[model samples]
Target: MNPNTTVALPQRGPAEHDRREQIIKAANEHFRHYGYSKTSVAELGKSIGVSSAYIYKFFESKQAIGEAVCAQYLGHIDATLFAIADNGQSATSRLRNVFKSLMKKGLELFFEERKLHDIAAVAAANRWCAATNHRAALYGIIERIIVEGREAGEFERKTPLDEVCMAILSAMTPFSHPLMLEQKTPEELEERVVAITNLVLRSLAC
Candidate 1:
């Protein structure tokens, strides 16, 4: 090795792939413990016995790490909703269960991991592409259920599909909204969510 020579770093590959997952996993744990704002790249690197620069080779910034964690979490939630949509249950049953499942998981995510909630909220407000696209896919699930209900004579088709999807989401806000969730009592929240869900369903009935 020449005194002034530096070797070029290897480009990212499968070897780097596992380390990247490790960083994301560690970041998730750190965010849960320390919150997103307080969780530093330096701390994450230290936790994994790497330098902050090395972590950057995997993720560009602290926010990037936070986004990765949020992505993973949201992906699981989406998968849950997607699975519910695919079940053999009636459209009404699927819709009802979607609300039930989302309410249960949303509360857990909001209360149990406040930091993760904040990260997700910011990601949406900032118009992160993944957030928008994932949300669109989620909306498609709801719309499909609505369309199914209409075809089966279980629901009215007066409203446009997009409008119905929007309305459904608005109705779900109480249970699914991440921010401002702490303002309501758990008992009241549950009651309100159930009432609103029923109201939305009834409005669509044939």
Candidate 2:
């Protein structure tokens, strides 16, 4: 064999990719219905008609599967905020949509899919740092909106970017925290979210 020879490694075929997706989908349903911790990798494989070893070929462990499920949950949200950030709307307008979408998603997940919500909560509790990173990725979208506002002369840089990001996340705690906001009526929640959005905009005024 010549040392200088370039080997052409095989790319993953569509069939294998499809199988992997099937596994993740099955894992999510198991987590959403039976709870994440309660679903073993073997159980997941059994449900999919595959062996646990086959499951391992896709995901190393139950924890990995849980993380994948959480990713699936966040994907829709990230796409929503991604669109908001990319739009030509004013920063204030984008911020309103951002918060509105987040609160709506929270209500749907917390009420309609309580077991899935529990899986996310348990994952965060067990892996605090990774969970923080997941939240940070979303917060970074807000930070990008703030930067745009500053550049467009609609907002003042009253504080550092990181501080501003944290402040926005802090202000949105009620909307993001399902337990606290769950008690409020729909009308009450809307009123609170609208009021806070206005307040946040005022603070960012130039």
The candidate maximizing TM-score is: 1
**C-alpha lDDT score of every prediction, in listed order:** 0.76, 0.74
In model 2, the runs with Cα more than 4 Å from the true position are 1-16, 128-130, 178-187
State how far residue 113 of model 2 sits from its true place (Å). 1.9
Candidate 2, residues 50-145: lDDT per residue as tens digits? 998887776666776677677667666667778988899999899889888878887787788988877656655664333455566568778889
What TM-score should be assigned to candidate 1?
A: 0.84
Evaluated against the true structure, the overall lDDT of model 2 is 0.74
- Residue clash pairs of candidate 2: none
User: Which regions in candidate 1 have their CA more than 4 angstroms from the true location?
Assistant: 1-16
How far does residue 189 in candidate 2 sit from its true spot (Å)? 3.0
